[model samples]
Target: MSVRDLLVLGSASAVPTKARNHNGYLLRWDGHGLLFDPGEGTQRQMTYAGVSATDVTWICVTHFHGDHCLGVPGIVQRIARDGVEHPVDAVFPASGAAYWARLRHASAFRDTGVIRERPVSGERMPLDTGDAPFRLVARRLSHPVEAYGYRLEEPDGVTMLSGELAARGVRGPLVRRLQQDGRVTAPDGRTVTLEECGVTRPGQKVAFVMDTRLCDGVRELADGVDMLVIESTYLDEDAALAAEYGHLTAAQAARVAADAGVRHLVLTHFSERYRAEDEPRFAAEAAKAFDGEITLVHDLDRIAMPRRRTSGGGA
Candidate 1:
């Protein structure tokens, strides 16, 4: 069966605590594994999360911050070490090309030439992923440094209405033909169109926003997405610090989700100032703004994507 989920490798922000490591998250969507914001100690964290270097299909870095891209060298080296045949795409801000080059060759090792550089430029743009099942887009974010966010959107499709099909006597092979050809002949010599027996099903969407203050890009990326993985670096009490450092507080993150109609809100990238006992406070603050599912993640947590919305229903 196909598996779609987010694997939390690490959740700490700039500093690492005994209970948390630097930032790292892996999104597994069927055959594609997108590794996002891999910070220091990501290799070890991946091992603990049961993720191998070969499983990574893409590495998306929001910025050149050490806590976001420091693990590039290790992951790249490990990819070469494992002799992963598939090409791994490395995506980041185009302005950070110099930093990426340094991290790509941080140490002397055999270069397998399997990692491809696909930097993101412009304010907002769709990335080329060949024939991937979903469309991937990048949008510029508000931060001291050049940062970007990513969104994955699947194509909308139609689901067959069993009741309609049975009523029309469109059973067995006729059902498949109706879906493929858009029309098929029923048992009573009647022609039935696909639209008459199917309802439009909106595609599933997920977004990743890291180390960015609230901005238009954040709203655009989170709009109606089924899952939103965002940074909540400070509490509402320290909103000033959050704005100064170009980050979001738990309440701010939740409000964004509520505004964008996000179904599952994942709050991560917490500061080290908060302790294990304080974790509940983050969820509590977020609950006031977002009534949907909220997850204050810990290292090695695996979160499943919300199920697809029912026909004619909102996510």
Candidate 2:
């Protein structure tokens, strides 16, 4: 059996509070895992989350921030220590090559497996790893350092109408041709249109944005996405600080989600000053502005995507 999910590894900002860890996440799909922003102590965090280095197929770092990529050396060392034979797909900002090189050789260790670097810089995204269910697109975000946001979209499928097929006398042999050619001529010399028997449904999309302020990239990435996981490093009261540091507050993220048509808004990357008691107020403040489902993330919280439904209440 295969499982697909986004595991919240750590959700704190630059500082790790007692309750919150640093910035880390693991997207698991089809028995493969992609770790994003493995912050400090990610190895132990993974162990606590029941994740292993062997399960990882990719490592994506949004930037070279100490809180985002500091754990890379440890994770790489673990792979080497365990002698993983499989290659690890690595993605980061191309401009951060120096940082990657330093982290790659932060300590003396053997190369565990193949390390393929998939760096991003501009609007366009590189090719997918060719294994995931969705196309991964990267867009530039408003961050002091070089940073980008990623969006994943699955392909749409055609919905067949059983009643239409039966009325048209389409059977096993004829149905295949109708599907392949989008048409079929019956013995009665009647033509059948594909649209008369089938309908097209839109695909699901997911976006991840972090360590950035409200910008066009946020709207573009979150547009029509089923789930939008973004950073909320501060509260609305400290909006000024958020701007100075290139971060978004809870309300700012909510407003963005409201405009982007995101189905679920997951606000994470919280500052260490706030505690669990403050999360409810923060969530409430965000909810006031955005009508979508809002979640103030906690480490190790397993969040499932809402079952497929019409877009924005059927638009």
**Which pairs clash (backbone N, Cα, C closer than 3 Å) in model 1?**
none
Cα lDDT listed for each candidate: 0.94, 0.84
Best candidate, lDDT? 1
Residue 26 local lDDT, model 2: 89
* Per-residue lDDT of candidate 1, residues 59-102 (tens digit): 99999999999998999999999999998988999999999999
Candidate 2 — which pairs collide?
none
TM-score of each: 0.96, 0.91
Listed per candidate, the RMSD to the true structure in angstroms reads 1.4, 2.3
The lDDT of model 1 is 0.94
